[model samples]
Target: MDFSTLCVHGCSKRYDTTGSVSVPIFQSATFVHPGVGLSTGFDYSRAQNPTREYLEQTVANLEGGADAIAFSSGMAAITTLMEIFSPGDHIIATDDLYGGSHRLFSHISKKNGLTFDFVDTTDVQNIKKCIRNETRAVFIETPTNPMMHVTDIAAVSKLCRENSLLLVVDNTFLTPYFQRPLQLGADIVVHSGTKYLGGHNDTLAGFIVVSDAALAERLRFLSKTTGACLSPFDSWLLIRGIKTLAVRLERQQQTAFRIAEWLSKQDKIRKVHYPGLPSHPGYEISKKQTSGFGAMLSFETDSKETAHRILERVSIIQYAESLGGVESLITYPMLQTHADIPQQEREARGIGECLLRLSVGLEAADDLIEDLRQAIYGGKANV
Candidate 1:
């Protein structure tokens, strides 16, 4: 089936004989067994739930992975992922990432005895330079959060294979609709399904997809032990959200491209970072590996004053955090997404106070442009 069809219809599996169009939420925390020693394939919600399972199967199918495990939120998925390595294991990760991930690695993971080297993975050579004998894996967020720095996943994956390392790619921004990291040789694909997969900003969810059954089993064990699995109701919400994923993203990408073009032409905007633009440093690599340039974008204003004004003025385009939803949002990474990183380090990574990240949504392009224009120029179309 085409991806569009898959998004709408999902797999052929039916949850019940009722023939309901939606996956039913198995609200029970524990299930009744048919026999003393036998089971009905489900025992408890902590281990698994029918609704969450259906959502997991759908995500696995979309990413073309062997299996996908769902979690309460993206952080929960990532926190559980960290358990795969023991104390003293070192991991190389992209310098620019969601602030939560950085906080986890720097504060929590380090205290737990895991060390991390944050490098600009846009150049696979940078990642290569960071690799040490203790480095067991590489974690990457392509078209990285706030910076929009696109990494060559295939190249990094090849390097990982050569060095006997696990390559984990955070596919949150692009989602499987635009890019499937597993197909590009990623050992594990992680997502903040709360973003694109959920489509609406109504529920929190996360997933980790792996191509190896052994890895899948390991992750499942960890997730069950942690007890951070998604609830049946939230899983159902995600299932419904994904039904319109294809259409929502297609419309969002179209609007984002238009908005990026507009931002690039503004004198107040210093530079626009979007892979869809031909001038982007990783444009060619992104084109080679992904089917589409996603709806996420970031721009650096000429001054911190300009960035603040835009954030305060926007009305229709909400000034908020989080991305990939039906409503467009503008965020200040310095204050919201990348604040966990030290000031000097954040600026060194090119995430300055003047930078603003935009998450294009289902809004009409022209309306969103007008909102931004008024926000930037203070009631004027352009300054």
Candidate 2:
């Protein structure tokens, strides 16, 4: 069977008891025991829920991982994974990263005695040079947030293997359908399922998929201890969301490529950051590894005023935070996504006031293109 089939029937066995096509939400907080000192493979909601398990198993299969864990939010999944390291451990991370992850690493993890070094992972040498004896893991976000810098996951994974370091890849921007990092030698894969995997902005969820059983066990223990598991209702919602991932992403990617090409030709646009475009820096590398270039892209204007005007003027594409929904969204990275980083650091990363990230959705290509035209030029497109 293909990806769409797996999305719908990957974990159907979990619903064998009810014989229902839709997985029922196991909403109970606790399970009953049949006899003394006996169990039914589940005892509490924090440890496991049937609905969450179905979603987890399906995701694990899709990502080619031994196990998958679900969380209340993307941050929760990352925070729980961070607990695997002891105090004073060091991590090498992508320089351009999600603001929430940066906050967790710069402040929260540092305070807990863990240290991190940020580098451009796209250049394997940058990561190789930064490795220290205390470096336990190399964390990266390929096609990094706001900047759209693509890292060579296989190359970095090789370096990690040589140094006896774990390779953790954040696959949020391109879900398993587009790219599966586990097959590229990454030890663990993480995602903000609230974005692509959920396929809608209505629910929040996160996932951590691992090929190594030992790593999966440790993460599961941390998830249970932290008690940040996704609720049964939200898990059911994610299941429905993922069932449409194949079709939704295809339409979204098509419109994204069309919009990116159009943006590149505009006089007001200074630069476009989309892997699907031939002119994009990551185009060749992206084609070599991932099955498809994802829908997320970022662009810059000639001036901050132009960016602000377009964001304010756009009618069809909402100016908002978060991405990967059925509806198109345009976001100002400097103030919205990367605001947590220090001003100097954010500017140094090339995430300036003129940069704007766009998450293309299921909207028609012509309508989306026209929306950008009117927003940037403040006039009819002469269609």
Location of the lowest summed lDDT over 10 successive residues in candidate 2:
10-19
TM-score of each: 0.98, 0.98
The residue ranges of model 1 lying beyond 4 angstroms of the native Cα positions read 380-383
**Hey, what RMSD does candidate 1 come out at?**
1.5
Cα error, residue 259 of model 1, in Å, equals 0.6
Q: Show the colliding residue pairs in model 2.
A: none
lDDT of 1 by residue, 1-383 (tens): 89998888776777699988878889999999999999989999999998889889999999999999999999999999999999999999998888999999999999999999888898889999988889999999997998888999999999999999999999999999999999999999999999999988888999999999999999999999999999999999998999999999889999999999999999999999999999999999999999999999999999999999999888888898899999999999999888878999989988898999999999889999998889888765532
Expressed as tens digits, the lDDT of each residue in 1-383 for candidate 2 is 79888887767456556677788988999999989999887799999988899999999999999999999999999999999999989999999999999999999999999999999988999998998889999999988998888888899988999999999999999999999999999999999999999988999999999999998998999999999999999999999999999899889999999999999999999999998888888889899889999999999999999999999888889999999999999999889988989999999999999999999989889999998999899986534
| TM-score, cand. 2 vs. native | 0.98
Model 1: residue 63 alpha-carbon error in angstroms: 0.2
